[model samples]
Target: MASMSDHELYPIGDAARRSGLSVSAVRFYADAGLIEPTRLNEAGHRMYDIQAIARLELVRTLRELDTDLAEIRRLLDGGTTLHDLLTTHLGIVERQERTLRARRAVLRTLIKQGGTTAQADLMHKLVSMTDEERERTIDDFWTEVGANLDVPDGFVDRLRAMRPVLPADPTAAQLEAWIELADLVSDPAFRGAVRTYLRDTYAAPEARTLATEPFQEFMHGSGAALMEELLAAHRAGESPLSGRVQRTVTLFLEAVTALSGTPLTAEARDRMADGYRQIPGILRQLDEEDAAAGGPGYGDTHGRYLALVAAINGTTGQEHDPIPYVWIADAMQAVQPA
Candidate 1:
């Protein structure tokens, strides 16, 4: 038609130059049926009309958006409606955007902290977890903890609810929190503490008598209070033999009795007293040696221990309080020579 004649035609080489693609790329697109040339010249060169060039530009744009050749072909072939294609691609783009945002936030945090290359590499690794990976990480942690215990009916849901959802554009604090959480879960000492708690709870003759209600209350209340008192005392350079420390221990023991709904017999109470007597020795060990110095080290041991305690007591938000199991294990390890 005369109207088609009005449109300028360019040879494949010229079209490639104008479209910012190589001739081979143009040939590939043509072969893929994405952008066909208008005609073949006398010398057998491909000739593209203005419209074909425009379509080639669109193909380039789609490629930049990471659309695969098959999808592009589907769009060109009308096998897929543009609306459907765009809707699907939108999700992909959004996910990629989230990943990029997380990476950028991590990089900014590292930059602000003047972090080492290793730290930067760690950030990258954390940011690279897919949605499935994140879900699996959370699920695995909860599953391991809940394996032996009679977790309440809605406990799993509650646990999931408590999990912090790291945003696509996470803050530096969130990133740091995630990293710490990851480290806490991954630590052998922490894992061992969790396993020990499971074993003790499952192996106990009074397992059914271990009421979750009282345990939860004690954790949030007196147990947390005791930990706070101990941490404060430890910080204040006060003697473990001090009256204040004794009073705190008594209060903690009374709370444990109240929660368990049983009176502590004189013998049981004496054993508890004996445990208190060992506190100063344990503190001395923690102060004298690093966590790695013995079979159980205190280096990061204290922090890791506290994190476990907080997690179990449901007071994990309380800073610097070690979980009881972790504290005991670390104490035992601290005494053993590496």
Candidate 2:
């Protein structure tokens, strides 16, 4: 209090220069009670000490960050801590960042897909759906497929359970996958084709039945692992008739029959081999037909749907060589011990 000579103050112009704010902005903040003059000069003009200049700088910074005037006012009034304000603001920034990424993904996909009005409208609709709505869309697809069918219990649930999950921060591929998958399931033609396939195949009265849970579990679990093993063997130039490949195929067949509650009989072997033999022709027919020329082939739609699911789920291993499978089919059909 006795060191009056140590006190220094500058006028409004100097305060604005020091704080990097326009004089009007400084004055506006002052009027808004965000910052005020440390004292009045002898001429009754506003003057600021060093502390007031620092406070003015803080106000300028907050305004630059898009903090509302009232929020800045609260901060200046000591209603909240700077730490808390910044923490909450950081979260807001992160959410905005995610939103921007998603928008970027959509825009890129739109460009890649030719950007027609129809495509744009589809993107808008897909992006506009809430997570629950998207989930409901998938549920509706599975429900309609299994409706009035004699499929096993949890059959519809099994179909619905492969829901594509879009991450919080999605890649461009994932967003594109979601767009395609959602559009596919929403299509009445696709739904009808898949439903017909299900009705004719699994829902048929004489269809061989497998327990839904065990079959799915084994397929996705051990069956997947075994396929990987077979793929590795194939890559290593092992013949389908090689000891390793044959042994792995044998174990796989045994496991499948066990899961289905059936014995791996010679007749079962013939049926399975016949089934594999038919795949290439079926795939070729589906591939040859133009999807736009007629209703979608059940197999083609299912494959495309799975490819999109793989993209969305960020999984791999879709590639295969039919040659190895053909050899395997021959091995299965050959005269062998049961």
Candidate 3:
């Protein structure tokens, strides 16, 4: 064979220069099976054909598109099975393009308005809470609770009923509610309150005691009825300071004692008597004060109290029903210093 110049059959380093790639890069591509040298020289150094140099250029182009090395190898190996990979890459590119377009739209709006830092901050917040992101946040909270508690029967249904579902177009109040609710659930104090409530219901020996069953039934049934009656009186313009109010209160207390398995012991009755003595003086004071001079009417005040109670109790009458009394108590306790 005739002796050829270095240009005719260059070594790996020269091939790299011709291909506009580093020698190390050429070796990596060869090792990755994207390209191979045509022959080896006397010292067993790689000798590349011109065609191999062309293949290196092609590999560099594919890599610039972010194609994986394994996929590159398949393309080089005559694998015509790259349709799925190309489709996936195209979808990703399309999504990125969409995001950029949205960002540009926001910037344009800001520019036209002579944007402030507040607008920029609002944009950041909104972008952070994509629909998918919000759903994942809610799902994560439930998932964590699911791992810890056997969700009581009807609890999930109640949650679905009471939970605020922010509209596709949410108002500022709704957004504020969501932020507060999220914060409440994430707080250790709130969690501790929830744990305590759950423990009281499910773990306490007293809760299972026969004496407690009657009390529970009374609270859920008769006590609820008494509350309804008192509410009705307030609604009817009856003075809560009147003798009628005292009579109703006495009857309600009697009902409680009757419903409880153990009647009020002598000591308890004595304590109750002491409390009763103080009530008449309070009622007299309330009588002397004008109804219009106080805060909201009794009915309105009671309604607000009931709403808070309902939220704490997790009771739901309608979608996004008011908070229960128990929840209000728990939340209040959580916020109180030990």
All models: lDDT?
0.63, 0.76, 0.55
From the highest TM-score down, the ranking of the candidates is: 2, 1, 3
Positional deviation of 135 in candidate 3, in angstroms?
20
Per-candidate total of colliding backbone pairs: 7, 0, 10
Model 1: which ten-residue window has the lowest total lDDT? 329-338
TM-scores, each model vs. reference: 0.39, 0.70, 0.32
What are the per-residue Cα lDDT tens digits for candidate 3 across 212-323? Answer: 5455556557766665665555556565555554455455556655664445454444444454455556545644452545433322322332343344334425333222
Best by lDDT: 2
Q: What is the lDDT of residue 184 in candidate 3?
A: 47
RMSD of each: 13.2, 5.3, 19.1
The candidate with the higher TM-score, 2 or 3, is: 2
Deviation (Å) of 195 in candidate 2: 2.3
Give lDDT: candidate 3, residue 295: 33
Error of 2 at 248 (Å): 2.6
Candidate 1 regions exceeding 4 Å error are 1-6, 103-173, 177-338
TM-score of 2: 0.70
Candidate 3 displacement at residue 255 in angstroms: 79
- Compared with the true structure, the alpha-carbon lDDT of candidate 3 equals 0.55
